[model samples]
Target: MGLLTIVTAAAVAGAGYVRARDAIVQRAQDNAVIETTNRVEQLYPLPARVFDHAALERIAGRVSGREGSAIAYGDGISAGGMDPSVITGELRSLVSSGRVGWQRVSYAGAVWLVVGMQLRITADGSSRSSGVEVYVLRPFTSEIEVVNELARNAWLIGSAVLILALGLAFLAARGVLRPVRELQLAAWQLGQGDLTARVPVRGRDELASVASTFNSTASSLEHHVGELTRMEADARRFVADVSHELRTPLAAMTAVTDVLDAETASLPGVAGQAARLVNRETLNLTRLVNDLIEVTRFDSGTAALALDDVDVAEVVRTCLRMRGFTEVSASLPDGVRARLDPRRLDVIVANLVGNALRHGAPPVSLTLSVAGSVAGSSLEILVADSGPGLPESVLPHVFARFYKADSARGRSEGSGLGLAIAWENARLHGGTLTAANRPGGGALFTLRMPLGGDA
Candidate 1:
């Protein structure tokens, strides 16, 4: 827009300058012609009285002295200071043919007005030529100076107009784009989850209307989101309450199931099968309840870390040993110690290794490493299994509670809360738990914990 304005201004300025210059030149030319004609009328009568070259020279000299001009006469000679050759042959011929002629010429770095007049004598009955011509040279320096000054002023005024127009264009663009920039920023904030973000209303323009509409939309979104948040909180509280209430009955059931498990081998075939099923189901239910409590603690922000300087490799080994994972392959680096929550770290390792053992192929591997600078270091634990890697559809939701990837598998083998619990425990220790597919065609889970003892 600024460029367009400058171009348009330049074209207008150019046209104005041309018109002004032409008018100035025309006025100067007219003034010069009028002054020359008046001088010729005064001098023509004196030249007609004389017939010889000497008398014509005297008359020409008198005219030069009176008018402060240069005068010449005859074919190519002059009595005054001017040269006869300065007058062109065409102007001389026209004067000899009884016609007045004038021309503007440049000489000696100054503009000159040259006029040609024929001297005529009225005899007793006829008018006859005296064979003498008068040519006047008048310098129009002052008029040329005036025209030049006008040209300079025209350029200066045109330039100022162009600059002022450009400045106004810039100001207008700024005024228009300011509201658009504000709207863009408000939209970005709203996208970033700031439901309270809104633009300010200004004048009663289109932009103001847009700002008012935006504010209204933001208010509606905030109200709806507030209601949804309240409902979600209520649901979480209900789950926490139900899980807490079931603990007492589940404890008694666990005790009864333990007794049934001890007597299952001595029962009859059908009864033994029923007893085993009940025992397994009771254990699964107990694990599910515990997992729910743990998740609630995380959701409520009540989960905390108990930092201790412990050997990370030792913790990994102990977790595997407690779980009776004898066939699991392990790679440990000696003296790999870190400040972390021992209990949470144990849970993270146990769940990852246990999941691999249950769902993945044999020859599961565990690796431990330390990384980063001395002041900001971390411990990384990698657990990999030689089983089919997770399906693309299941990888994203692998840590979601009760998310079973294989629907064909009944609920007898394991609870689906293991990975989710593991992820929460890692987060409680200011760490991250991620799952991926190994290069050799298996599932890999990585646990990274900060060594700075921060939760």
Candidate 2:
């Protein structure tokens, strides 16, 4: 708006200045013609009298006032007030043709109007030229000053109009943007988790409509978020309750399965096979139930660490030995100990090694290393296997519960909760467990734990 006002004001001022200057020049030209006509009338009777150079000088003195004058005849020139040479030949030619000749020209750095006219007299009962011509040089200084003053006024008025227009535009912009600013602040609050944030509605404009829409969207979002939270909570509660209820019956089934395992050899072939199958399925059910209970503990925030000061390398070796992962090689260094949760550390190691044995090829390795001082040391356990690395698609969801990479493979032998449980245990101990593809064609699991567990 300001720019448009500026351009408009400039154009108007420029055109007004031009018109005013032209009118002033025209008025000056009209005045100059009238003065020349009056001077020529006064000179009409001079050529009728007998005149000498001295007489012509007197006539020239009467004709020329504060401006300038020149009277030209054969072998004689009378000039005063200004130089007579300023009258050029073009003006003289027009005068010889019996017409008033006038031209505006610059002389001595000032504008002057040179007017020339021929004087005539009645001789031998016929009008004849007297050979004497009158020329007048009138300066246009006063008229130029008037034009300049008009230009100054035009520009001043243009500046005032521009200022007033800019002020009005600023007020209008403020009125439009106030509601936009309110909506911006409200959006920021909503993004920061303040679901109740809202914009105050003002007039019935586009900005007001936008604010109203934002308020409606925010309200709907808050409602949906609340519903999702309750649903998630309800789902967790159901799992916890079901797992809790199944534990009692699962204990009884495990005891019965142990007896059937002892009597399997004495039964017939089909009955013995059936007994073994029942025992195997019972064990699988028990594991699934226990895993669910553990998941519930994690969901309920009941998982905790039992910190103990023990040699990390011995813990790794013991975990491998208990899990019967004898085919796996170990790079455990002795004489290194720290405050840790040995139990959760064993579980983490067991899960990693068990997963490596079940899913990967031979030449598996487990390495334990310790760093920092005893008070603030950290431990890293790297378990790698010589097998095809995890696919890029499967790496991210490796620890997700019951997530199978190949859906058509049906259910895997072990519950899919192993890696998830391992990850939870690591997180519970203020550590991290990560899986990745080894650079040299294998899968690697890295576990990092602060030696001084968060006690």
Q: Report the C-alpha displacement of residue 421, candidate 2, in angstroms.
A: 3.5
Supply candidate 2's per-residue lDDT for 418.
85
Candidate 1, residues 1-455, lDDT tens digits: the string is 98888788778877876787778767766765566556555654443443455665665765453434555565545566676667887887888788778777877788777777766666666777766677777776877787778768767877898899889988989988898899899999999999989898889999999989999999999999999999988988998999999889999998998898899999999999998888888888887888888888888888888788998888888888988988988999999888888888888888888889888998899988887866587888899999998999999999998888997888776678889989988887878899999888999999888877677
Q: What is the TM-score of each candidate against the true structure?
A: 0.83, 0.81
Per-residue lDDT tens digits for candidate 2, residues 268-364, read: 9999999998898898888888888888889889887777889888888888788788899999889878788888788789888888887888899
Structure candidate 2, residue pairs in collision: none
Q: Give the per-residue Cα lDDT of candidate 2 at 117.
A: 75
Model-by-model lDDT, in order? 0.81, 0.83
For model 1 the TM-score comes to 0.83
Q: Which ten residues in a row have the lowest lDDT in candidate 1?
A: 43-52
Q: Which candidate is the best by TM-score?
A: 1
| Span of 10 residues, lowest total lDDT, candidate 2 | 72-81
